[model samples]
Target: MRIVEGIGIAVLVLLAALAVLFLRRLVIARQGGTIELGVRLSTMVPGRGWSAGLARFAGDELRWYRIFSFWPGPRRVLTRRGLAVERRRTPDAAELLVLPPDWVIVRCINRQAPVEIAMAERALTGFLSWVEAAPPGESTPETRPYRYKTG
Candidate 1:
């Protein structure tokens, strides 16, 4: 009887935690210019470092928060001043299975660190537009038009 009660309580706690995560995702998505994004910090293993997250444009920074995280702050912040898009590509077979059908992969450099982002076509368009519209003289020459490539 005690084991049964323990299991029931554990299930309830799990449900409650899931509800909280869902609400957090909802609140983040309600913000302006927020989009579903997948960011991978490593490039050592191709098509292996993706993590689903929400990214929002705040001022001149694009802040990323993990989808399941409880923290209210961004996990990573990429500033417009030091971010550059190196190239864009279609996700390969392995990535396509894991990512959404319409999501594209983009390689970028932020503060001298490489970051890969996977997002839908519409979100990628918005991101490029935002980067292009940066404040005068804050843009880097590296922010040139993206060269398309296959994954």
Candidate 2:
């Protein structure tokens, strides 16, 4: 019957779309500098705006792509210039449900705009190192010259 054929075609289309998404994720994960991270665009409510994504550190840009997205490009690209880390904290009860157990939250200011990133400890270390390793003349908060105490 026509109804049966329609249902069958719909199922096939759904499966094909799923396959494509899986392949895309595989390819993206295979790229170097790619790491699984959660990005919160809005910090109005803690633990409410987190979206799981793949973040790639490319040169001076951090490109983020949603894990389930079909698009081949990054959804958000954060630049290293004028980026500074404000603080780091552990997630609350609600956030733990959405984020991994070992992940930590980091607040940052990018070009004076607030951005929150959630990632595991190792990834956090790498991120901090990257931000601090900016090229000369590109200053992040942690990259400033240290002042020595002369007693």
Candidate 3:
């Protein structure tokens, strides 16, 4: 009986250790990344389907800090102050300026505050389309100024 009890305790300890390791990995993955201006639209709604698709696309297209969560609301607007602070902290990190395919913005605030801001899908689509359509030579005014057309 003592041998069985000892084995059970050992198994519990192993499981607990594994859980801790997994959580650590999650935190490390969430922290340490810069935010950039970029947008993405999804055909699916804002839930598991959209999240999965976004994850797959991010993995394939660019290296990003894990998407904490998305917010769905009546309007679509990225908080200037929130993003500004994040950018200031991690200048090198790419900020995902997303107008979610759905009416939502995935937001992960300090691990404890995870939310989905709502917005219009059409609005997000239009914004993303514009960004994609912009000519390579044309510069966005947000971060750069135009000099002249070289080509």
Q: Tell me the tens digit of each residue's lDDT in model 1 across 18-70.
A: 99999988888888789989988566787777788999999899999999788
Q: Which wins on TM-score, candidate 1 or candidate 2?
A: 1
TM-score of each: 0.89, 0.86, 0.23
What is the C-alpha lDDT profile of model 2 across 1-151, one tens digit per residue?
9999999999999999999989988888888899899998666785688999999999999999998889999989888777777788888898998998899888777764678889998998899888778788667335433321211
Computed on alpha carbons, the lDDT of every model, listed in order, comes to 0.83, 0.82, 0.32
Q: Rank the candidates by lDDT, best first.
A: 1, 2, 3
Model 2: worst 10 consecutive residues (lDDT sum):
142-151
For candidate 1, report its TM-score: 0.89
Runs in model 1 deviating more than 4 A are 140-151
Best by lDDT: 1
* Candidate 3, number of clashes: 20
- CA deviation > 4 Å runs, candidate 2: 140-151
lDDT of 2: 0.82
Q: What are the per-residue Cα lDDT tens digits for candidate 3 across 4-74?
A: 99999999998887776556445534543223223333424433222211111121122222343322111
